[model samples]
Target: MSRKTLIPIGPYHPLQEEPELFKLYCDGEIVTDIKWETGYNHRGIEKLSESKSYDQVFFLVERICGICSTSHPFAFANAVEEIVAVEITDRAKYIRSIIGELERIHSHLLWVGLAGHFLGYNTVFMWAWKYREPVLDLFEMITGNRNSYAMFKVGGVRRDIENSKIPAIRKEIAVIRKKIDLLTGAVMDDPVIHARTKGVGILTRQDIIDYGAVGPTARASGVDIDVRRDDPYAAYPLVNWKVITAQAGDVFAKAEVRLLEMYESASIIEQCIDALEKMKEGDITLKINEIPEGLGTGRAEAPRGEVFHFVVSDGSNSPARHKIRAPSYTNIATFKKSCIGQTIADATLSLAAVDPCYCCTERMAAAYDNSSGKKILNANELIALSLKRTSELRKSGTGHE
Candidate 1:
């Protein structure tokens, strides 16, 4: 008989979220069922935003998640704009896009590196972090803060991209793009990664629709949905770019989608820079003192997924009600479908394939052998086991081996 064992991931640890607990039901080597517990680190940013005025809300929402710092503010800004029916300046539009894309680059690199780490790939961890520094440097140069970039406001962007810096920024992006291509090839084309990730954690297209999954999680399942394209915002309409999707709906598919998307993000920023170069470095924002009595909803295609913000105003400076929905909220649910039927060795990477933030921030895992009541593997050790499984499967020329 296959004994039922519960693998507890974390309650205060990081895997895809800030702090969440997951209990995976395993029957020997195969994960039979999974249930998760969350809400470990809730700062109540939504409730706090109600007390702050529209202008002040930007700073508060940016702290929702350090990785998604811009995403929150970007969505909040859009919600505010919708309520007042305010149209921002053209320069501000492109600036917002540039900043948003830069955020995407850094956030994706963080995920790729961390995912690599969870798979026993230290070189990927080092190189990914190394290349990510320039993106932060660019953010620091533009927004004065690398992580909590307080660039997006209700009316427009807070800062303008200097015309003189365009040449340098493009140079940096070109170099980084080349490195990303190399890294992407290393992971995507490699047979071992395929052996480890392919056909694992398969989330069908219907599963995505059922769970309301977004971003790479859904895109990896071959779902054609992106807030940037389906619902155009900022400079997305002006720039030419394609949304990347994969049919396999496995860990490798998720990796391919993200890796390919980075190139598109870089290209979007390049296009934005070109647009910025032609225009004068004019007003970045148009300040609004009051918000009218209306409900506003806005969404931005965040790095991990879609960041949706809802604001209720009663002609007051502060919001009457503030609701924030990070992609992690929806993306986490899909794990129920993806995790089951996967081996204990594949559970860690399967969870990682979704890349949760607000839901997935750090990697944490625990493997318990139910029959003997012995906790067996740590997160990295699980990766080692997965790697070993890969080796065995590759060497024997059969999965049964």
Candidate 2:
């Protein structure tokens, strides 16, 4: 007799607010097949961009994700500036690079905390978040905002780092570096962390390339593809740093890749600070007489992965067509392939291992109870029931999510 089981993961879970359904077909304790359903949060932002001007689109793209808000604007500005042939000042470029690195640091820390929370490690979650506060404070100190640091403008950045703030900025970075070192030790030395994550959700080198993975996901699988090095944008080429990579291709490897990347980002920030000190002041932005009809493409290394923005202008204030390729889109696609043959217990961690940004991925939908007239289960209740089913399926060692 052939036995089969079905398991549904979530449309809403504490770990992820985005609605994605994972259907796992299994026999006994092994997952036989996996299927994924997305498009729950399709906000039509890309289509909406067509109605907005290049300047206005910057703000629109910033709403793509709360975590990498600055990166979106930075990439969009670069694309627009390229179309107009605007040459931004060296000082502005260094400033942009510095803030970008700082964003990367905080983004990675945030991901680390989320990863801890998914694994039920509340202590690590709290500690990582507490440490992340300093980085946000540094951002608020510089740009006057904690989340949306609207520093980047059309021709150049909106504001420049003043001489008076130099010493304080340097001191803040020193403290951040110390915190990173301490966190690194805890991540590497923690026995529970390794037990739950080290060998879980292995994505081999070939699998990574076949699935078209990017950012830290691809890097963890030993793929040396970084837009910063491959396409040398902004001041990335001018600064010195190594592209961090790992050969393990597991959840632990991905975490290690991000952890080590913090050090590299710190070094890049230090380099930018030094470059800023030597840079001379000049016009931050160039005067654009007119915007001609042109198509421009801009790609940046977002904290999650690679972010691509394609803009086509028809000599009008608004773009004729604007397309945004978020990293989460591609990263989420790989979950179907990665989840097969794994236990349900590994489902949450594995899905989360890719460092998903559901807020960027899914659109909000009304939570409804589909149980019946007798009882209506909320979204959270449904998710909890699914978890219970997944546990039952895994008890036989033949389930996946």
Candidate 3:
């Protein structure tokens, strides 16, 4: 008897931190097809950016993803800076890179803890999250907020990493490096973990390329694309750090890439810290009177992958148009490639392997009149609605007029 069943894990599942629906069509234990839904978390952030000043847009974009908060601001700053044609101080460069790398370490640790919990390995979860606290503490010490550091701005950073603080930061980094070593060893060497993740949900290099996956998802499949190295930005070009990759493209391979990348991130942070030690602080931001009419594209490699921001300036305080493409936008699409043919039990882990950020991946696709149950807004209509709302806010003296 060929019996098929549909199993759904989402829209409000416990496995995911946010609401995303993943539908699995399975025959017995093997998943035959998979489909996922978004739009449940859309907030129209790009449209909102047009109403805020260039300086304020950094804060707006930073909330795109809590884990990749700084990542968005870093890219946004790069975009606006491109429009302004301004160069930030070298000291600011090092501080920016240090903050970026620290966020990478903390974000990877968060993913590792969540991955452990998903696999029913509570001890690994405990160890991973416990060590992650120190990294968050480092963020608090430097930027005051553990998640959304708000350290970025156009042309430069908001805060300078003082030379006096480098020693303490290095001490914390050393402790974190030791903890990472232990966690990496345990995960890499555990026979149970190997059995659960090694061959499960394997994605070939072609799959990664076809899906246009980024970050660890693509790197795990042997794709050597990194914005930090390929499209050099901020202090990444000044620092020496190699991209970490794995050949398997499986769940274990993804884990391997993230773990090894943490080491690379730490190394990059140390080098940046050393550079910061030789420079004097206080040259953090560059004053820009205005952003001239131009279009600029910026790319930053977040903990998951490349975060791209495009800004169009119309010689105004606010952006004429703002567009964002987070790494998860493409990475989430890979669930179709990795989850199909996977066992139902392995499908969720495969989905989680990419560390998809639902909030970062959503956009308002369509709108309807709920009362009439009829489509009322298409893409153009949605844009008009956005513009209209911005105009209303401006008229009310709430937006940058």
Candidate 4:
């Protein structure tokens, strides 16, 4: 008789930096079943948002995720703008689009680098990250911060792009586009990447709809739903762009979708620059006379997927209730289904296929101390411990073995 083996891959694993556990039920090298557990980094940002005023929440929302900070505030502000009926200027809309696409560029580059690092392709990782530096530099040139731009206000953007900066932005766009094309071609042509990614973990179209997946995850599965197209906000409706889709429903498909989308993002930025060049200068923001009691919902396509923000007001300065529906929240649910019946080595790539963003959409479950017979640590504590251990192992050269 054969024995059943249970291999725990996380709560601390090299493949995932986040504090989530994957118990792989396997026979030899082949995985038979998989179970996931996540409660390691829940900060309750949504609950905390209810306590903050509209103006204050903008800053709070930025902390939801470092990578998608711009999109969080954009979504939150869009909700508030809808309720207040704020009329943003055309220039502000173009600025918003430019900032958003810049963020997408940095984010996709970051993911590509991380994915490469996960697969032991250190050279690819280094090359991808080298390309990402310029995007971050361009962001700092405009927003004054590399990560949390804090450029979006409830009514409109905080500042307008200076006339002199237009030429620099165009030059940066042209340079970055050429570089991205070169790197994306390299990624597609790499045989090792193709072997590890293609047909590894697949999500069918029906599975995407049933699981409420969004962003590239759903698009990879042939579910053509992008908030930019389904519910256009800011200048998306005014722009000329098409949603990128893949029918393969596998990890390679997701990677292709993002790579192609980056090209589209560059084109979008070019369009925004052109639009900004022609717009007449005026006020970037509208005066908020007062707040009326109402509820508003805003949805935007973040780099990972659709980000949703709901705000309820009681005619006061602060919000009555605030809820955030991060794209990762929906996308993470399909992991178990996609990961089952695959090799343990495929686990990391499969997880990366969804573009998991732990810091943005995570909620921690309480931890128990068996020795003390009590719950001793919170989710954040567990996450910190997990990250600490992972870092220590990487430094000591004795972790994944």
Highest lDDT: which candidate?
A: 3
Per-residue lDDT of model 1, residues 192-298, tens digit only: 77788889899999999999999999999999899999888888999999999999898888999999999999999999998899998867789787788999999
Kindly provide the TM-score of model 3 when superposed on the true structure, using C-alpha atoms.
0.95
Tens-digit lDDT track of model 2 for 343-383? 77676688888987765665423344566544455556755
Taking the candidates one at a time, how many backbone clashes does each contain?
Answer: 11, 7, 1, 4
Write model 3 residue lDDT over 169-273, tens digit each, in one string: 999999999999999999999998999999888899999889899999999999999999998888999988899999999999999999999999999999998
Better of 3 and 4 by TM-score: 3
- How many clashing pairs does model 1 include? 11
By TM-score, the candidates rank as 3, 4, 1, 2
Clash pairs, model 3 backbone? 11-20
Clashing pairs in 2: 28-398, 29-397, 29-398, 30-397, 30-398, 41-362, 41-363
lDDT of 3 at 187: 97
**Candidates in order: C-alpha RMSD to true structure:** 13.5, 10.9, 2.2, 7.7
Q: For each candidate, give its TM-score against the true structure.
A: 0.87, 0.86, 0.95, 0.89
For model 4, the stretches where C-alpha displacement exceeds 4 angstroms are 364-401
C-alpha positional error of residue 221 in candidate 3 after TM-score superposition, expressed in Å: 0.9
What are the per-residue Cα lDDT tens digits for candidate 4 across 372-401?
Answer: 879888767875886787689889998543
